[model samples]
Target: MRTDMPAEIWLDPYRWEALQEILEQDGTDIEEVLQNYLIEVYSDRVPIERQKEVDRRIKKERLAAVQEAEARKVFCAMHIREHGQEYILMEKNGREFLQVAVFLRRYLRNEFTTPPQRVRPGI
Candidate 1:
């Protein structure tokens, strides 16, 4: 799974604006034009055999990932559904889980705070 954000290519604002205006004169989006341009450049540079091998690997990996996700959904549906049963989760010795809890607490501290108590009418 590709979970990380893509890297950005910074462009000169003035040149980019001029190029964008020219590109959009034909009702074309800059992103679409850039993507097509990249594909054209890659095709011109890379051999057909190498590109085919890379495409095959990408397809295999993505399909395997999709199948694993579907299997996880099936397992959860079969075993983890709401019921009258009690389940206790056991954690292996790891700081990762503890760190996640601490991070969550810091992120959501406002939500967990109690409201101030009301004062008595007559003290």
Candidate 2:
């Protein structure tokens, strides 16, 4: 496969041009068609593997953003007791504040918790 050759040719440039011209003529209902064409053209250039990676990256970034937002929300919730009152749990804290909460919860648990689990499993 020659790299110089067009990866994919637009099959209906005339139709595309006609659509554009019609839109210009009537000035309505062209956004959907243009979006479809744009998506088609975009998909053509982006290889399947690259597209997958791009999608994966996009999803990963979205997830990370959500997670960070959630962490902030949780941190804020844990911090503020009322309109003006700041909770001691979140105010006097460092990065290990959440960890402290976890350890405290574990210590307070009454049920038979699992015995100290191995940090590293046998290989």
| Top TM-score model | 1
lDDT of 1 at 15: 85
Query: Which 10-residue window of candidate 2 scores lowest in summed lDDT?
Result: 114-123
Reference-based TM-score of each model: 0.50, 0.37
Give the distance in Å from residue 10's predicted Cα in candidate 1 to where it truly belongs: 3.9
Off by over 4 Å in 1: 3-7, 74-123
Q: lDDT tens digits, residues 23-114, model 1?
A: 88988867888778888998999999999998898888899999997666521111111244332222233346566466345434534354
**CA shift of 55, model 2, Å:** 0.6
Query: Across residues 7-107, which tens digit of lDDT does each residue of candidate 2 receive?
Result: 34364878877877888787654665566687898799989999999778878888888898767653311322334433233323344657866744553
Looking at model 1, the pairs that clash are none
